[model samples]
Each structure stands twice: as structure tokens, then as C-alpha cells.
Target: MKYLLFLSCLVISITNLYPASAHKVEVSGDVGGTLHIEPNDNPRAGEPSQAWFALTRRGGRVIPLSQCNCELAVYAQPYAAGEPPLLEPQLEPVSAERYKGIPGAEVVFPKPGIYELQLNGKPVSGARFKPFEFKFEVTVAGGSTQNSRNLRDVNGDLVEGESQKLPTWAIALPILGFIGILVVVLQNMRRSGE
Candidate 1:
């Protein structure tokens, strides 16, 4: 019974060691669908950042890229209080329902501040869907600051700051649980032999 309890604790702790995928922001479109946007990495000032967008109907059907003409517009919130700077972000279709920001032509925030992304487009050719528009807010951090970090993973891929560190408990508890389980199993086996 003690051995079984230790094994169950070890299994649960091990399962929680690895973190889940980062969360993406989702917005409902005015026309008739939901827009999902996932940034390749956290947006940094003066650094190019790529993001993926997907459009899906209320019924969960994906809208094909060929059937829609879409564009993304980026605007930086003014610091003192003037009008924001408007920029056109280049985007390319990745598949029927997915689009990615072009690497070189991707959006780069001019400074660390609040930014707004406006997505607009209409159904193309023979598509009967209405024009869609979406707006989302993004907050960038440590832009051009003295303490700014590259924020890339070991594979040179961009990652959010929150995901940079593994929780201490997540690692320590799993290891401790596994060690306890091993000890319990060895003791049980020795008693059974005797």
C-alpha cells in the first residue's frame, strides 16, 4: 500500500514538470467569426516580431485564405499625446485558414509602449462572407532599455518572458517524489524476498 501511494505521487509530480504551451489572444470579429492571434514571441521595441492569425466561423469552420483579402495595420500609442504612428504589416497566407507575418516585413514596435493591431479585409471573388474588422491591444516591455534581454529560447526562437524560467517546485517535487518511489519499491521487494 505504501509503495502504491508513493508511485501515484511520483506519477502526478512527473506529469506536471513540463509546462503547457503559452496562451494566445482571441477576439471576436464584427462580421461573423473569431480571430485568433499568436505572437511568435513577445513584442519588443525596434525588434521585428512575427505573429500568426486564424479566422474561424461561429460554427467552428475555418475561413480559407484564398477566399478573403486581409491586411494588418499597426499603430504605436503616442508617448506625450500626439497621433500614433501607423504602419502596414506584411502578411502571407500559410494555409487555407492560417496567415503569418512576413519575417522581414514583420511589425516592429518603435518603442516600449501600448500598441494596437487593426485587422481589416473583405471576402474576395465569389465569397459571400461580409467584410470583417478586428482590433487588439498589445503591450510591449523592456524596449531599448538598459536591462533589455534578447528573450530567445535555446533554439534561437522567440519566447515570452513568463515562460523563461522553470518553477522550482515543479522540478524539485518531481525529483523527490521519484526518489521516494524508488526507495519504497526496493523496500517492498526486499521484504517479499525475506
Candidate 2:
């Protein structure tokens, strides 16, 4: 009984570390991947956010950047039929171990609202992999004081590219909170055992 209760609490705490809705998996016949957005997947306007794709082909084969010709586009809600994406983020290969060499980008939202990110890709050469497209909806919070300026790189280049590292405190707080919750749960278990 104690083991079951402990396991239940453990699972609950682990799951709370990230909201269930923040991560999304998209699959197509040719290729598929889960899109990851950093800073808890809730980006803020005017701030740089890291986004990447962990892609795989059929049979769970990893898709490296050199093998894919990919583009990523971000659009505001209520997307128009003939309009271009609000932002066409420049794609670079991420260095993350699990996502190493996968297409990734840094993006900044100009406003707080619902946004759509569309990822399209095909084999770099030959008939290696079929074309694939994946879409993800993101709800951004906060607002940007300077929308026009936020869309550019530091050198004033326009909407073609962007990471602010989170503070240590921001990282530490959640871990501390999780520890506090675990303590309380363990205390309760001890009392119940008595």
C-alpha cells in the first residue's frame, strides 16, 4: 500500500513538471516529429524562445538536418488564405543530444495571442524521404512594447531569424516547489503509517 501511494505521488509530481498540453506530436506518412517550445512552451511576446523538431521517419529512424530541406513559418491566428506567414524563422540545426542536427530555430512573438507554426520539409536530395508538413498551435502570453523591433536580429536585420537564457532563479524555483510538494506528501505518508 505504501509503495502504491508513493508511486502515485511520484507520478503526479513528475507530470506536474510540465503541462500536458505544452508538447505536441505530429505524424505523417513520410515523417513525423514532436515540436518543442522552450520556457515551458508558453512563449512571451518580445522574448526569444527556442523551438525545435525531434523528427523521425518510419521505423523510428532519426532524420538529420543534412537530409532534410526544411522551412518553418509562424502565422497569427485566423490565418489568411493568400497571405504570407508573419515570420519565416531561419532554420538551423540544434545541438541538443536528442534533437542533434534536427531543424530548429529561435523565434520572438510580436504579440500575445494564438499563433500557428507550420513546418515543411522534404528530402535534401533524391527520393530519400517524402515531403512532410506539420502544424502546431501555440498560445503566447505577455505583450511586446516594440513589435517592429522585436521581429529582427540584434543587427536590425528583418524577420528572418533568436535565445535569452532563463535566470537561475527561474530554474531553481520549480525544483524547489517540487521538492516542497514531495516533502509534504512524504510527511503525510509517514503520519498515515503511524
Candidate 3:
């Protein structure tokens, strides 16, 4: 039936509306797990982006910020030897699922390009997750990136990790939906005229 075909097309288009938001796994010495960046993977230039780390050990014990002396340093990609870090954002403990009191910070990319965020941590008191130095390569796009943490959303409410900018599916799905509707209408007209 035409209706059934239209419903199927609608379902397919709706399912592609979400973008990938998986936390990135980092390669470090003994203390490292996942790193999550707010507002999606590719942060844009001239906006504050929040980044956090979820560290675990062999037994999967969570490493809280209270137990580690961590430092974050950012460097431009293709960095030269002995070059100083471009910026060093202060580390703060952020509370969230699996990242309760974990090391996090806000960073603003000055321009669009490839950059590396490096995290080095050591035990503050007793040895927690062993010393680690994690590196993550982040690509910055040339535009203004806004997130709920730093800006108002569609509902004028602040919700972490949500961006106001329209997503790829938001643009594509509407076009596809319109086309599907048009097809259904055309099919109905043809049948009625018969």
C-alpha cells in the first residue's frame, strides 16, 4: 500500500537522526579509560567546550579527582619538539554518571585546526590508578560552537551536552519526509482519477 511505503520511509529517516556520541578511549600508561567532549566529537572554534575523563583500573574501580594530581595541556597539531603548550586549562572535578568527581575542564579553541589535549596524572595520597599520560587529538571546525552548558537551548533551558545548532538528520529528514508525503499524495490522486 502507499501508506505502508510512506511509513517505512519515515521510519528509516527518523532512525538516522542521531549522531555518534561514544566516549573516546585513550592510550595511557596505567591510568586511562575514556574521554568525553561536550557538544559532540568535533568541537568548533571560538566556543567553550567541556571535556572529562573516566579512568578505571584492572578491577574497574573509578578514579576520582580527589585521589589524583592531574594536569591538562593542549598543543597544536604537528607540534614541534620542545614547544610549549598552547594552553593549559585548570582541572576541575565534574560530577556525572561514571565520571563522578572526575577530572574535567573547559577549553576554548582560538582557531580551526587539529589540536592535542594531553592529560597527566599522579597519585595525590595513596596510589590509585597508576601514573598516566593520555593524549587525545581533537579537530576543531571553523565556526561558533554553542552548548547548553554555555548557552540557552531551544526551550531557553540549559541542558548539558545538547547543542542548539540543527543536526544533519534535522536537515535531511525534513526533505525526505516532504518527498515521501508528496509521493503519497501523488499516488492518491492517481488512484482517485482512475
Candidate 4:
């Protein structure tokens, strides 16, 4: 009984250590620098997501955010018909060297696919860097349009499509297992008392 309880606790602890859908990607700037973007969460269709960016020189020196005015432009690659509309993301300084995508200003990915993100800005404080422009190819995960059930299927892939619901058994099974363990522990205690 104690062993079962210990194992259950161990399993839950281990699972909590894994990240819950944050995605980070790095792109090389045209001026021999590195741009790192960490979307607060995995990009989903029609759902608001904020991304943080950090610009560092080739030798690992951070660039002051106040010295530059930055803008983000996202273009969905033409997947179906005519050219998709270009989306301009609102970026604001979160710190001296970091910028965050503003809530309403950030573009929600219309669908899951590759997007071309252009980060362009000019140095306002007489920084030696030229007008910087960095482009990155980002892939967004598909999300269901009808409901907000962020569940993975049996194959461990994100479940997409309308009319698809997360299986109740998936949630119930873990709870049932924990209850079963507790019942077994109580029974063992009762038997030992006798």
C-alpha cells in the first residue's frame, strides 16, 4: 500500500516537470546577430498568443531595447488561393533588452501552417547596427475552431477538427487509479488493525 502511494506521487511529480506547450525558436539576424523568440504558449489558430524577443550580438552582447524601435510583420504563405493578408504584430518593450507582443496587437495565426515573420527595426540611439531585419519561418499547431479542448490523441498528436472531444476516460482513468490506491491503503490499514 505504501509502495503504491509512493509510486503514484512519483508519477505525478515527474509529469509536472515537463513544459506545458511553450515554444522557443532562434533565428539569425542579417547583421550577424541572433534573435530569440519565445511564444508564451504554442501558437494555435485563432487563439491569442504573445511572444517575447531578445536580440544579441554575434559575440553574445545584448542590445538595449530602448535603442531600437521594432515591428513584427507576419505573412501567411499562400496555401490556398490569392496572397494571404500581411499581419502586423504590436510589439512593446518588456525590459531593457526584451520586447513582448501586445495583447490585441499580436496576430492570431489564422491556421496551422508555416508563416514568414519579419522583425524589422531601426536603431534610434545611434547604435552602429544598420536598419535590422530578421526573417523567421514559424510553424503553428492546428487547433479546433469550435471548442477549446487542448488534448492530444492516443498517438500523442494534437487533436484537431470539429466534433472531436477529449475522451472522458483519459481524464477519469488517472483519478480512478488514485482513488483505487487510497481504497487499497485503507483496507490494508483495517486488516492490520484486526
Residues 1-194, candidate 4: write the lDDT tens digits: 56677867855854353356533445445343333333444577777665555665566555555666777778887444455437887776554234332112355788888887777767676765567777666677776565545667899888854575557876676677767766877787889889
User: Which runs of model 4 end up more than 4 angstroms from their true locations?
Assistant: 1-41, 79-85, 95-105, 144-194
lDDT per residue as tens, model 3, 25-138? 875666556888777766788888898888777667778888889899999998997999999999999986645899889999888999998888888877656788888888
Pairs that collide in candidate 2 are 106-162
Q: Say which candidate scores most in TM-score.
A: 3
Instruction: Count clashing pairs, candidate 2.
Output: 1
Question: How well does candidate 3 match the true structure in TM-score terms?
Answer: 0.64
Worst 10 residues of 1 by lDDT: 96-105
lDDT of 1 by residue, 1-194 (tens): 76678688768758685445443445455344333333434667776665555665566556656667887777776433455547887766653234332112357777788877777768778866668777667777554433334477999886655435557886787687788778879888899989
> Model 2 lDDT vs. the true structure?
0.81
- Assess each prediction's global lDDT (C-alpha) against the native: 0.62, 0.81, 0.80, 0.61
User: Could you tell me which residue pairs clash in candidate 1?
Assistant: none
Clashing pairs in 4: none
Candidate with more favorable, higher lDDT: 1 or 3: 3
After superposing candidate 1, which stretches have Cα over 4 Å from the reference? 1-41, 78-85, 95-105, 144-194
Candidate structures ordered by lDDT, highest first: 2, 3, 1, 4
- Deviation (Å) of 71 in candidate 2: 0.6
